[model samples]
Structure formats: structure tokens, C-alpha cells
Target: MVTIKDIAREADVSPSTVSRVLSNKKDFFNPATAAKVRKIAKKLGYRKNTLAANLVKKKNNIIVVVISSVETNFSDQIIKGIQSEAQGIGYDIMYMYTHTTNEEEHKHILETLISRQISGILFVSVILEKENITLLDAAKIPYIFVSIKPDNEHMVIGSDDQEIGYLATKYLINLGHKIIGLAGVDAYPYAGFSRIKGYQRALDEFGIEANEKYIFYGDYSYNSGSQAIKYYHENFSSLTGIVAASDSCATGILNYAYDHKIKIPEEYSIITIDGTNLCNITRPRLTSVTQNFRKMGSLGVRKLIKLMEGKVNTKNKSIFVPVKIDVRSSTARLTR
Candidate 1:
């Protein structure tokens, strides 16, 4: 275990200088002396004791990311954005998964994070209960919600899901799709419900009657997409276009269509939300309303940093990243 004292002895500089140089606080040190200290430390195979250093300072430059699971395809992009931004600013990222729905288990996770002395937290696609919120508030740690909008007033970073739904639905409607089916959009998480509202709003603007039978509410999963297809086939035979909740759900719909020998575009045009790389790989490709996932992540980190720094006017404000549509082969003008 090489220490700063060992490097200081070899470089003939004081331990304080070595510590400052190694920690990147070198503005007060001579450039050549700082360089020599770094060379000696590198030669001695020195590694930082982050936990000990954080203990001494009573805080850490670590951001904890909490997610239910890495089930969505766009999660990777969001993480990439977070890492890129956090690393650039000399912060470390720690991922924690919340698999249990139990409130006690959720409390344990929050307690563990607080014990770590982390600088802040980012909640990705995981909604915290009121009790958990109270715990976080009591701890006085900064946290920002990402990707999902909660009912309470909190700092959140994500797309306008209602606009996403309206954009996807209206694209098909403009292409002569009057009888559109919506799949895998459940009635929870402000995002889901807002998207449903957006879909209905588009229909009403176009004078098309919104039918409840045309909507399939399901968890945003591949299985949910498959079941939506089956349900629509049996219940709504006049469906000519579909708007999916996510790229994975859209892929599931495509898979069901292939297995059932349903001709895409000729039979039904489809558009999905969450424009991840998966959209390009699907057969015929998918037309998607792309959320700025990476931007959401990067902006969340920036906002969290502000809150951690105790910047005034940073709390209680939510940011909604803009979304756009990427036209592709999966959606076409309805000719039938």
C-alpha cells in the first residue's frame, strides 16, 4: 500500500503538497514540483483511499443512481450520458437496484446510500413512496428524479411524454390512419397517463372518436407488447395504425406480427416511443418518437450538482427535455 507520505519522501516535497497534487488541487503548487510528485506517486504504484479521504472531508464526490432494474433499452444511453458528464466533473457514479416493492426494503436502500456519504442521488425510472421521500428529506441529501415524473413536486428531468404521444399519434393520423390502436401505455406514472391523454387529444383534434376499446394498458414490457397485439386482434379488428409505449414493446408487437404472418404497413402502421438503438435493428425498422434520454441524464447530474452545492433557486424546479420523431420504414400511409 503506497501512501502520499512515501511519494513525498521520494519527491523531497512535503506530504501536503503530494496530497494536493494527487487530488488535483494543484493551483497553489509549482508546476514542475507537482509533476515530479505525480511521477513519484505513479512509480510507487500509489492508489487513492477514497473512503478514507471522504471520511476525512465528511462528504464524498460520489453520486448514487437508483433504478428499479435495467429493463429498458434506453437505460444504457441514459447511463452513458450520466457517466460522461459526472466523470468530466471529477465525480464517481454508483448504481443501486431496487427490485423489491416492499417499503422496508426501500428504506434499507435509502439508509445504505445515506451511510455512504454520497454527494447526491439520481433516481432513474423509480418512483419513491411518500415515506421514502420523507426519509430523504430528513437526511438533507440532494436527489433528482430522472425519466419518470412523480405526482409530488420534485426536481425531475425527462421528456414531455404527452407531446410524445401526440406526435406519434398525429403522424399516423396525418397519413390517413383514423382507427389507431394504443398499446402498453398504463394508467400510472404521470408519463403513461399523459401520453394517453396526448393520444386522445390528437384524435379529438382530427375529429376521430376516441374509443376505450382501442387502448391496451399493460406494463411496458416485451410481453405486454405481444399481449396488446393479441388483444387488439380479437377486440378491435378495424385498427389500422398503432402507437406503442416503448421500443421494446414495439419490438414485441413486431415479433407477434411476424409469427402471425401479419403484413406490416400493408396491414397496420406502427410508431413507438423511446428511440433507442433497438429501433434500428428491428425488421423494417421502427418509426419512433425519440426522447432525449442522454440529455435527461446529463441535465439531471448538472442539476443535482447545483442542489448539492446549495445553490439557491435550484430546488422545486423540473426540466422537460424536448423530443423529436425519427421517421422510418415501420410507419407508412394507410392505404386500406
Candidate 2:
């Protein structure tokens, strides 16, 4: 609770002299005088106001991690990566969830962080409006988008989802899965649509007809995956392979087939994206295209730091984390 005035009054010096001594601004005060001020300040149990100091210095070592929601495993992994990297650099991180739609809440959070002198922001799977982006620009607060790229041009860190899709399809193709079905996403964020595009491209490249009926649209959930499989069973009865938008979707398909007495890898070969830990616990471990969530999270924080430090300009930067397929027990060469 002790202010510079209190320290100065007790030390019998000007507030400016006390400030200089506390800030370690040498050559402005005699060594003995500075020492005496420090000794008195220590005796008074003085604690420095970090917020005020940061306001005066025009910088802070705090980074705000703004997420739309934390319901997914991907979000947890990304946060871990962000925390690890931030701690290594002697920076502190604070979490703020916007829930993706609450504009007023998001604005209030931004204002609070700005007032508290936050140095940078890391948006995880959250999109910003043009007005919000403009506001951050005007306030001179550096921000980096993580997980998914925003519509506006800004610094972003995410996976090459289209490439991930293509790779998943290609893997199925290499295993001779000619009638490969797609359990697609029916929501926004380019990951779903891009992966569908990659699936179609892989089919086209392999000289196989990409059947529209085989592509079932669903949200990224276990029920959606189950529904897709049900649709596949009812319509594309001959479909022997499937590429899902997420691990949960793939798990859905696996669960449905198990309950219905259908065999996997023998009757159906399945693969999914976002190869999180869900791949391991399935009856037959799922074959998955793994996204480097940790690496993406770490790289995103690093990019944000660089932007905050003025080491990188905010001129449409993009960091694409790569993806790879992990062949497991669920997918096999289609003998049919």
C-alpha cells in the first residue's frame, strides 16, 4: 500500500528521487542516498505496483489467452503448450473465454486487459470481428490467432487442414479403399470444408468416383459420426472405408459398428483427423491424422511474443503446423 510519496516522505527525499532509486535509474541519485531510500522502503514493507509500473513503462510481461471455449481436448493441449513456453520466457498468461458470440463480454474483457497493460493476446480457435481487430490495431495491442485462421488478414497459427484431409484420403487410397466414404463437418471454420476438398482431390487423383451419397454431413461430435455411419449403412451399403472430420466422429462410427455387431478393419476401415488421445481407447485403436496441437500452441505463443516485442510485423503472417497420419488398428487394406 506504500506509494512513492510515502516512501519519499519517510526517506526525506523527493518523490521523483525515490522513483528513480526504486527503478534503478542510476547516475540521477547519490549511491548513499539511493541505498538509504531502499533501506527505508524495505523497512516499510513496500510493495511495487506492477500495474502502475507497466503503465509507466508502456509494456508488461502478461499475455492474455482468449479462447471461445475450453470444452475440447485440443484446447487443453494447446493451453499446456502455451503455458510451458510462456513460463520458459518469464512471461505470465491469463485465460479469457469469449464463447465465440458474446461481443459485449469480449469487448469488456479486452478493455480490462488493455487497462491492465497486457502486452499481447493469443486467440485460440476464436474469430474476431473487423471492428474488434481495428480496435486492437488502434490500441496498438499485438494479437495472434491460434487453431483456426480468421477471415481478416492477421498473424495466425494453425494446421494445414486441407493437407491433413488430403493425406487421410490418400492413406485410405493407398490401402486400396476405393469406395472410401467421408463423414464431413456441417459447421463453419475451414477445417471441415477444407478436409472435404482434400478428400475429393485424393479420390480424383486415384481415378475413383467421389460419390456424393457416401459423403454424410454432420457436426464434429460422436452422435454426428454415428448418424453418418447409419446413413452410410442405409444408403452406401457397399462403402468399405471412411474418413472422419475428427477423432470423436471416428469413435462414433466405431461404437455404432460395435453395437451393431459389425467388424472394423475387417468390414470397414476408418480414419479420423485431430489425432488426440481418443485414438487409443477405442475398441480397435483408431487410425488418425494427427495435428501437432502442442507445437501449434508453442509456435503461436512465440509468434505472439515476437509481435509484442516488435520483432515481427503484423503484416499478414501465417504459421502452418503440419499434420501426419498415424496408422493404427482400425484401418487396413480393403480386400473387398
Candidate 3:
């Protein structure tokens, strides 16, 4: 609660003198005077405000982490990793979240972190608007974006979702399910496009005709998954296997199938894109692609810290985390 004014008033010195002493500005203060000032400051429990100190020293050692939605398991793991690594390094973290429709998130983020004390920013699967991204580039603050798609012009850390799509489709194909359905978004922020591309590439390699009707585009939510399934059941009678872009989507398919009296593998099989515990707890465990959430989180934090410290150059800034497909009960050997 003590301000610099209070520290100066108690120390019986001018505010500028106190500033010079605390900042160790040897050009202005003698060793004896600096020592006395330090002694008095310690006695009064006086601490420098990070923002104030950073203005003079030009470094603050604080990081900001922003997520689009913590509503899902994936975002939570990123936060956990960031928080853990940040705590270890003694850096303060300012966390923020944005809504799906909040167009003003950029202004708020800028206002919150533009100070000298804010050394770096980490965006966990959150997209910045065009104007705001331009602002971020101009600000000279070190940053790392996660789960969020890169404009390919900024520093972004995320998984190779295209590979995930490829793996999921290839897995289904290997199991003799040539009629595998693809489900994911078709929008910006890259996950949708990259994942879908992976799926298409896999099918192309196998020389299978990709039925465009079997590919359902959704908003990457549970409800969308359900809707996709309902559409497929009504329209695509030949579909025997499905690959949902996310575990949430996969769960939706599983629930729909369960209530509709469809036998798993006996009738159809399903796979999802994430390896959360939700897979195991389902009526039949879901075979899913694991994106290593904890690693993603930790990597985001570590990258932000390094950029904050100016330890790395940002000329080429792309970090790709790998993915793994966990075989489980939901995806069984497709039966004719």
C-alpha cells in the first residue's frame, strides 16, 4: 500500500533522490547515499512498483495469458501448464477470456497489457482480430499464440491438426472402413481447415472417392456433432465409420448413436480428435488423437517467457506440437 511518495517522505529525501537510489543510478547517487536509501527502504517495507521500475529499467518479467474459452478441457490444460511454468519462474500472470461474439476483446487486451511491466503475452487457442493483430505486431511486446491459428506472420504454438486428421482417417481406412465420415469446422483460425485437409489427403492417398456429402461441417461443438450425426443417419446409409474433429464432437456422436439403438462396431464405429478422460468414461471408450494438452500449455508459457526475456529471435516463429492417436473401445474393427 506504500507509494514512492510515502517512501521518500519517510526517508527524508526528495522523490527524485529516492528514485535514483532505488534504481542504482550511480551517475546521480554516491555509494554511501545508495546504501542508506536501501537500508531505509528495507526498514519501511518499501517495494518498487513493477510498472514504475520497468519504465526506468525497461524490463518487467510479467506475462499475460488469454484464452478464448475455458469451457472445454483443452483450454483448461493450457492454463494449467502456463500457470505451473510461470509460477516456477517467479513471473506474474494476468489471465483473460473472451466470448465467441466479443469483438472488443482486442481493445480490452491492449489496455490491460500495454504497460512496461507486461513483458510478454500468451494467447491460448484464442484468435486476435485483424486490427488488433496489427496492433500487437507494432507494440514490440513478445508474444506466443496457442491453439489459435497463425496468420503465418506471427509467433504461434500449436499442434499439427492436419496430421491428426490424416491419422484419424488413415486409422479408419486401415480398419477397412472406406466409408469414414469427416466432421469439423470450415472456418478461420486454421484448425478446421488443417484438420479437414489432413482427412482429405489421407483418402486421396488410398485412392478412395471422397463423398463430399459424407463430410459434415459443424461449428466445433457438441450440438453440431449431434446434428451432423442426425443428418448422416438420414442421408448416408453407406457410412459405417466416422471421425469427429474433436472429442466433444465425438461424444455427441456417441450419445446420439446410443440413444438411437445403434450397436457400436456391430453397426458403426467412431473416433474423435482428442484424448481426454471423457473417452474412457463413455459407454464405450473412444479412440482419439491426443494433442498433449499439458505440453501445449507448458510450451506456450515457456515460449512467452523466452520472448519476454528477448532470449530468442522471432524471425521464424512457429512451434508445432505432435499428436498421438489412442486406440480405445469406441473405434472397433468395422464390420460389414
lDDT for each candidate structure: 0.86, 0.82, 0.77
**Local distance difference test, candidate 3:** 0.77
Q: What is the TM-score of each candidate against the true structure?
A: 0.89, 0.80, 0.81
Highest TM-score model number: 1
Task: Please give the range of 10 consecutive residues that has the lowest summed lDDT in model 1.
Answer: 97-106
Prediction-by-prediction clash tally: 0, 0, 1
lDDT tens digits, residues 73-110, model 2?
Answer: 56777888898888778677888877654567777787
When sorted by TM-score, best at the front, the candidate numbers are 1, 3, 2
Question: Which residue pairs in candidate 1 have backbone atoms (N, alpha carbon, C) closer than 3 angstroms, thus clashing?
Answer: none
Please give the distance, in angstroms, between residue 3's alpha carbon in candidate 1 and its true position after superposition: 3.3
Candidate with top lDDT is 1
Worst 10 residues of 2 by lDDT: 68-77
Q: For model 3, what is the alpha-carbon lDDT of residue 39?
A: 83
RMSD vs true structure, all candidates:
2.9, 3.8, 4.2
How far in Å is the alpha carbon of 281 misplaced in model 3?
1.8
The TM-score obtained by model 2 is: 0.80
